[model samples]
Target: MYALYYTPGAASLVVHWLLLELDQPHELRAVDIAAREHKDASYLALNPNGVVPTLLVDGQPRYEAAALAMLLADRHGDGAFAPAPADPQRAEYLQWMFNLTATLQAPLRLWWYPGDLQCDDEAVRRGARARFEAACERLDAHLGAHGPYLLGERLSAADFYLTMLMRWSRNLPRPAHDRPHLGALARRMKARPSFAELYRREGLEEWA
Candidate 1:
């Protein structure tokens, strides 16, 4: 069985969502980041990075959320979360997913580590927040132009990844609500059946 090492309310949310979408039989194993269980020796051996959301596919460990999503999508069916490889939008689909990880997710990490790593200097924190807002604004505008999903109409892995990011970003004191379209996109995604299923399995009551 597919064994997913996850931490509830973490990046694992998307992985959980996608696994439910695939309707595959799998096991959800929680790794407590608070107690430092993710950093344990065995977990380190399985995933040297010691990060949560490691997918154990038939015993071999697979880390990295985006790569895991792509692998799962491709394995389940080429046409699942992403379009067929030949589709014109495929390029943008891949681009958005990676861009979310590199550009969008970085700022959220700053929010998590604000006091420790980023908020040391007022000027530095302000600059980081400014850059983060710009990125979110760009995403908001692009999402508004698309009018539903990142790919215009159909849902893709890009939307799943991005929507989860937006949701977490919204929880910050600054909130992504200022970006109405982005907020709407996140709401639409949260309302999805697959998202609800994963949330339930993970015991994420706050997500509802």
Candidate 2:
């Protein structure tokens, strides 16, 4: 059986959600971050970076959320998390997923480090916030243009990643859910039964 090394509340949430969506059987091993378990020598051998959400496949480790999502999608089927590579919408789907990881996630990170960016220096923090806010604005605009989901109207992994990031964004100096469309999208995702089940199983109180 596959064993997923994860923390209670981390990017592991995405992998956990994806695994549930795939209906795959796997073991959930929570690495206590508070105890520095992830930094242990044994854990380091499994994941050199000492990060959570490392999937142990056949006893081999596979990391990176985007890669894991794509791997799961491919392993599941053609029309599930991802469409066939030949499909026209595949480009847009992959684009949105990567955008969540690359564009959206960075700003969300800064919310946890406002002063570290030297927020006192208007230029530093302002520039960081601007960069982050711009991404949120672009995401908001994309959601408005696309409507219901990140890709047109079908629910996809992109939505999951976006929803996860938005959950983080809510605590930011600038929250994405402040936008009507973005807020609505998050509400829709949170209301889904599948998401609720995953939350319950993980004992996650709230998603957004």
Candidate 3:
């Protein structure tokens, strides 16, 4: 069984959702970020970064939500939710996974937490928002051309990852779900039973 340390509706949602999607045996250990539990000594031991979603796999701790998602999908050996090493779609899969984490997720994080960029200047925040929207535009175009899934016809961990990020964008100036293609994608993904289960389990509402 896997142990996942998480705070509801955070980046942790993606990894937790992936585990359930795979029907993997796992337990969620809540680390209440609001109460500063994550910064405490005990939780710090599990995740020095003091963030949510610290995953313990085979009794070893790992952090970073996207990396954990990739690891779990790869480790499962089914290659249905994730491509195996030799799969032909592997290249595109890797490309978008890295792109989503690096390009799209980075700007969203910066935009959402402007303090992390060291100044609450509106200009800086606006720039961050602009960057994120541009990234979304690119993603929208890609989906319009080749999606129903990030990898053309088949869904993957990348889509789940995208779902979490898109959920975050609900409060943005031009929210991700407002884009026609992205909106359609979000609607399709939200229809999955796992999505409803995740909402109920995590107590997430509003963005739905």
Error of 2 at 194 (Å): 2.2
**C-alpha local distance difference test of each model:** 0.80, 0.78, 0.88
TM-score of each: 0.91, 0.88, 0.96
Query: lDDT ranking from best to worst?
Result: 3, 1, 2
Where model 2 places Cα greater than 4 Å from the true spot, the runs are 113-126
What lDDT is obtained when candidate 2 is compared to the true structure?
A: 0.78
Off by over 4 Å in 1: 115-124
Query: In what order do the candidates fall by TM-score, top score first?
Result: 3, 1, 2
Clashes of each: 0, 0, 0
Residue ranges of candidate 3 with Cα displaced over 4 Å: none
Worst 10 residues of 3 by lDDT: 112-121
**RMSD list, candidates in order:** 2.0, 2.5, 1.1
Say which prediction, candidate 2 or candidate 3, comes out ahead on lDDT.
3
> Which is superior by TM-score, 1 or 3?
3
TM-score (C-alpha, index-matched) for candidate 3: 0.96
